[model samples]
Structures are given as structure tokens and as C-alpha cells.
Target: MFCLPVAGIGASAYRGWPTRTGDIEICPIQLPGRENRFRAPAHTSMDAFVKDAADALQPYLDKPFGFFGHCFGARLSYGLSVELAARGGPLPQRIFASSCLAPHRGGYFGGGRSGPFTPETTDEEYMEELRHGCELRGEPTPPDELLGLSIQVLRADIALTCGYRPPGPGGTPLNVTTISWTGDTHMRPEEMDEWSAYGDVHQVLLTGDDFTHRSAPADLLQVIADGLPERTGVLTP
Candidate 1:
């Protein structure tokens, strides 16, 4: 499975996950402008990023693979899947979209706010939002410097998300599995049912708060394992 991180986070967010679960090998994609790629510029255009990502991920498509994306990463994963399909490239066996609204759903709602956070949003506003999310997840807030960098990346990412508009009427569909947490106040489980519009969707309701997916608990891992094929060998990139 290729794990895609949520907004304002890097692939390191998935470091705690087991490298191999059952017959699946976890591969977390590291986006530019974060973690080890801090010097690189973050992508601000979803279309451009998807196009480039489709090309870059070509080598890794040799074997059967799937995608696991949380929150904003769900949208990114969907975009990449669509792009790859358009290019007649390999497609994921399945997509696990966690804590994310469907593409047709415009804007975002989180931290008691609706609509995407614009570039006009002040630094303090972004920090307060981030702090609130961490507090809700019962996690420690990052240091000032780290928080600052996250805010920078978040601004660009949110722009990409906000600028994105789903295709009209009959958009491309994929094999989607939507996972919703009962305790996730940010994105209600009922709202995620819209994912059915995209493809054959299997809705899963887990018992945990919003950030529970970050921990990679047994139940979550089991859910993922059940969704994948029983093939052996390491899936890369």
C-alpha cells in the first residue's frame, strides 16, 4: 500500500506503521517541500502535481499495489489515480480513503470552520488551527520553527485543494473503500457515503477519534489487509 499523508504533514507521519502487514508492504510517498525534501518547493497546483506524480510513479507500478490516503491525501491519491488512468498507466487495485470528503464536495470543513483556508489567512490563524487539531488528537504540538514550516506547506496544499474542481457529471470512477471514524467530528461518517458516487465503495466505520488512523492499530491494519489481494512479495515506491 502507498500511504499518502494528510495536509501539513510528511511521509514521516507514517513511520510508525508496520513495514509489512500480512502480504502487503507499506510504502509511504514523500512529497516535496517537507521532511527530507524541505529545500524543494511544495506543489500548489493539483493538476500539475498529479501529472508529474503519474510519470514519476511509473517505475513502481510494476506490481499490484493500492493507495491509502487520509484527509487531504485522499484527494491527492484520487487525483493521481485519475491521472494514471488517463495516461493508460497501471491502476491501484483499490483505494482506501480515510477521513476525507468526496471530490464533488466543494471546499473543506475542519476546526469548526468551513471552506478552504486561503492564502489571506494569517499565520496566527493557521497556528491556532493546527494547535487545535493537535490538542484534539491528544498529541504534542510541533515546535515554533517546525510549525512555521508546516504552515507554509499547508498554505500551498490548501490552495491546490481549493483550486481543484471535480469533473462534471460522469467523472472517472475507481475501486474505493471509504473509512470513517465514529469519533471524527471534523468529517462525519454519514457524509463519506458520497464516495459511492466514485465507484464500488465499501464503507467502513471504525471506533476512534479523528487521528486514530495515525496510530495504525490492529483493526485498521486488518481492514487494509482485507482490502488487498493475497499476492506475495514486496510492493515498492
Candidate 2:
């Protein structure tokens, strides 16, 4: 499984993920401007994100593999899959999109931006969000660990998410599985239907399960395993 990182999550997020590197390998898609790889500025657009991500992950495309992405990462996986197909390369055998709604759902989350954030907010708000700090009252405070780590990468990612107005409709010519919290605030149950545009869409509802796949490793493993036949028959070494 090629694990794509969610917004504010780095490749290191998969560290000690309760599994071995043989049966399944999690390749955390390292976006530019994140984690230890941070040295350059970040892009605020989806297209730019795809271009940079594809380039960075080019070396890993030596074989076909299952792609897994949650929330922001899900969008990246779809984009990467499409881009590779467009370029006549080894396409992804299966794409697991989690936590996010359909790409074409305009007005998602009450539509439009929620107005500007206070300037008091850090320049990199995405980084600030994942800060391991406990909130006292409603104000955000950064923890020592987060402060020590470079967060500009996360901030840039939020800028991209905020600025995005998903273009066109959802339709990827690839096999896909959609997983979401049945009661998730961000994803609507109806939105899962939109995934049919991508061909062979399987929707998994974690009715009471939390966001973390670790919450149900057995189930996640089954989904990954079910994908193998399609992958084995279709994807080359």
C-alpha cells in the first residue's frame, strides 16, 4: 500500500504503523515544503501540488501498487493516478479515498470560504492545527514539540485546500474504493454516490469507527487484500 499523507501529516506519520514492510509498504507521499524535506516554498494550487508531487514520487513508480490517501491525500492520489495515465505510465491498480467527499461536490462544507481568519492566526495555520497542544478555552497555543518542528509545510497545504474550488466533475477512469466516517462532519453519506463517476466504486462506512485506520486494522487489511486480485491480474511487477 502506498500511503499518501493527509494534510499536516508527513511521511513520518507512518512510522511504527503496526506492520511490516514486506506484505505491504506504505510510501508516504512527501509533498514539498513539509517535514525534514522542507527547504523550499510551497504552492497554493491543486495543479501545482500534483506536478510537484508526481515529480517527487517518480522514482517510486517502478511498479504498480495500491494507492491509499485520506482526506487531502485522497485528492492527491486521484490526481496522481490521472496524471500518470495521461503520461502513459504504470497506472494505479486501486485507489482508496478516505474521509473526503466527492471531488465534484460543489459547495461542500456549507459552500464558499468561511471568511478570513484573524491575522492573529499564524502564517501557517495548517501546521498550527496539528500542534500537539491542549486548547485552553477556544484559543490555540502551540506545543514545544510543534514549535521545534517546521510547520510552514502544513500552513501552505491549508492555503491550497482553502483556495481550491474543485474543477469540473468527478470521473477518474480507475477502480476506486471510497471510505468515510458515516457520521463524519466533513463527508455526507450521499456524497459517496458521486464516486461512481470513477468506475467500480465501493463505499465502506465506519458507522461508529473513528478516523484512524488503526482503529480497525483488520478491516483495513481486508480491503487492501481484496484489492490484490485486481492488482495481481492487472498490475505488473
Candidate 3:
């Protein structure tokens, strides 16, 4: 499976996840502009980033792989899955979108600015955003240079998500199994139900907040294992 990271983070965002789970091999997506890719420019839009992701993940799709993402990353994974299908390539057998609502619903991180973050966002406003991010991450606000970098990448990601446009009325639903996992404290049941518009949806309401994917990976793993196809006696990996 492939795991995508939330805003202001890279592949290391999933550092807490177990290396191996049953037949599942957790391969995390390392987006540009963070961690080892710090020198690279961050993607400013979800559409563009997903296209790049699809191209980059082509080789690994040979097996019955899956996509998993948390919060902002969930949106990215969903977009990538769509991109892969559109490009006539392999599609994920199941999609696990955690701690987020469907694409059509805008996120809490973005405050009206659906475009790139510029000198436009005042210092105070940006700080507020950072504080909000800290809350979601369940961490103290970063300081100095680290804060600056986090704001940059996070704003870009928020812009992408806030500006996302769902298919118009009557648009066809995605032909894949989608699992929406939202924390009981983080999102309301009504919000999680919105995912049904995406496809055949299964909802799992767990006990925790937005950071549950990191805080309780073992529980998440069990949920994933249950959803995975049963080859019965054999473990593929």
C-alpha cells in the first residue's frame, strides 16, 4: 500500500506506522519540498500534484496495491486514484481516506484563500493558520525557520484542497471501494457520510482526533487488514 502525508509533512509523517502488516508493504509517498525533498518546490495544486504522483507510482501498480491518506493526504490520494484511472493505468483495489471529508467539502485549514499563499496573507493571519495547524497536529507551534517552511508547504496544500472542485451534478461515481475513516472527535457522522458520493463507501468511526492515524496505527492496521482481500491461506508478501 501507499501512504500519503498530511500538510506540512513528508514521507516521514508516517514514521510511526509499522514497517510490515500482514501481506501489506507500506510505501509512503514523499512529496517535494519537505524532508529529503526540501530543495524541491512544493506542489501548489492538487490536480497537478496527482498527475505527477500517478506518473511516479506507475511501476509499483503491478500488484494489487492500495492508497491510504490522512486528512490533507487523503484528498491527494483520492485525486491520484482518479488520475490513475483516467490515464488507463492500474487503480487501487481499495482507498482509505482518513480524518477528512469528501473532496467537495472544503477543509478547516483554508480560510477563503484558494489561491497560492502570497505576501497577501498578513503576518497575523499566517500565524493564526500555523497555530490552527499545530492544533490539528497535536503539537506545539514550530518556531523560527521551521515555522516559515511549514507555513509555505501548508498554505500551498490548503490552497489545493480549498480550491478543489467536485464533479457537477449527475457525474458518475468512482468505480472503486472507498473506506472513510474519521475520528469520532474530529468529524461528525454526517460529514463522513458525504463520502458515499465518491463510490461504494464504508465508514469507520474510531475514537480519537485528527492525529489518530499516527497515534494509533495498530488499530488502523487492523481495520485495513479486515478490508483487504482474503487470499485465505497465502500471504502475498
- The top-ranked prediction according to TM-score is 1
User: Could you give the C-alpha RMSD of every candidate to the true structure, in order shown?
Assistant: 2.3, 5.0, 4.2
lDDT of 2 by residue, 1-237 (tens): 677776655776556464433355555556666677666566667778777766766776765587888776777677677777767867777988877666654322213524222213564553444443224123366564665354555556656665566543543477888887755655665656777777677888766332555343666767766774543222112
Q: Looking at candidate 1, what is the lDDT of residue 146?
A: 89
Worst 10 residues of 3 by lDDT: 109-118
Preferred candidate (TM-score higher): 1 or 2: 1
lDDT tens readout by residue for model 1, 1-237: 888888879998897798988788898989998999989999998898897787788887888888999988998998898888888868888999999888877554432246435557899999888888788777898888989999999988888887787672257778889999988877889878778888778999999977888889898999888888645567565
TM-score of 1: 0.92
lDDT for residue 152 in candidate 1, whole number 0-100: 90
Q: Tell me the deviation in Å of residue 120 in model 2.
A: 12
Instruction: Rate residue 135 of model 3 by lDDT.
Output: 77
Model 2 stretches astray by more than 4 angstroms: 19-22, 106-151, 162-171, 207-210, 214-216, 230-237
Q: Where is model 1 poorest over a 10-residue stretch in terms of lDDT?
A: 107-116
- Name the regions of candidate 1 deviating beyond 4 angstroms: 110-120
The residue-level lDDT of candidate 1 at 137 comes to 71
Q: What are the Cα lDDT values of the candidates?
A: 0.83, 0.61, 0.69
